[model samples]
Target: MDLEPIWLSIKLAMITTVILLFVGIPVAYWLSRKQSILKLVAEAIITMPLVLPPSVLGFYLLLAFSPNNGFGKWLHQHFSLQLVFSFPGLILASIIYSLPFMISPVKAAFSHLPRSMAEASYMMGKSKTQTFYRVLLPNIKASVFTAAVLTFAHTLGEFGVVLMIGGNIPGETKVASIAIYDAVEMMDYHSANSYALILFAITFIIVISVFVINRNAVKSPFE
Candidate 1:
């Protein structure tokens, strides 16, 4: 019945996807190009969330953000930022949980491109930044678009991590996933089905849109 949770989930997904675009781009670029042995370790770290259970990650995060813990204490003392049981906590958890969704697509995008494009740009007196914007990004923009949509959808469906860290706080951390969970717990199948159906519809449409756009991009001569 309360729509606040749905809006909150949308807000969380949007913000998380936007931030991950910037963060994931650089990381994905690095992973795609770097050849050092340490790069393997770094990639594993970034992709760890994909295999790790959400509740496991959430449990550790909860401890890491507990006020009694050193890191949490430092955060509160210096920046007055409380990560546990707050909107900020949900953001942080979602970011971690959704990192691979954004990064993998971007990495694939960059990896699939020809190195000659970047090399030619460098030879033509373009800086790395310029090469990225002018020569590289345009060719692979579809992957980035895919990453954004995937991240948004993934964040919207999060439950265990958000629950462990944010605890279903209405108008704040109580996202649609949590709402469905609560509805089911209260023996309200209708409410649960409504939220679930809405989430499914939104995610389905987003994914279908991404596939359509990707196909078009691939078919386009400009791409």
Candidate 2:
């Protein structure tokens, strides 16, 4: 069994999860509290990935990241970076595709926070940033953990977007999902099964681990 793609998939999922944690935290916090219509619009935009066909999302990303496009060209001119069919491009696509998995859980957690806690912190003369970091975040640790696990698992199974934008470049963008596809196309059952089993095992572990952590977190006195 070719282990390379399996390793690549893990790498992709890990990087995507880390990026989503930072990006999703702020977005989820905003969505949880913001009353503006723009928040609804933004939520719709982020949740689009969950509803839209992977191919459709991938098509837009392909065009947007292509060097011919204005934004893409500007990036290329400034950084000499080419995203098309590259590892970084796949990472970007994975992050976008897996955004809702990260955002929704964290948003729910943030929304579940008691308003009284934030008010008490404010009454105690804490700034907004201080209240969020010192008060709100500590209360939502489980949700953040849930978001990271779900996002990582979802990113690991991604096929359509990675296939469309990544083009199966070996040791670069050729993740396990794409490698499995290639194995199937070649009628290599053994290789396909190996990749599939590894993916399944890793994802299963992640899901189980999330539940375990969540259960323990819920039972902890800190909560």
- Highest lDDT, which number? 2
Query: On residues 1-223, what C-alpha lDDT tens digit does candidate 1 reach at each position?
Result: 7878888999999999999998999899999995788888988988998999999999998999887798888999999999999999889888988999999999998998998899999999999999998888888888999999999999999999999999977887889999998999999999999999989999999999999998998785866
Give residue 41's error in model 2 in angstroms.
Answer: 0.4
RMSD to the true structure for each prediction, in A, is 1.6, 1.8
TM-scores, each model vs. reference? 0.96, 0.95
lDDT against the true structure, each candidate: 0.91, 0.92
TM-score of candidate 1 against the unseen true structure: 0.96
Name the runs in model 2 displaced over 4 angstroms.
220-223
Over the stretch 1-223, how does candidate 2's per-residue lDDT look in tens digits? 7788888988999999999999999999999995789999999999999999999999999989889997667789999988889998999899999999999999999988889999999999999999999999988988899999999999999999998888988899889999999999999989999899988898889989998998898795866
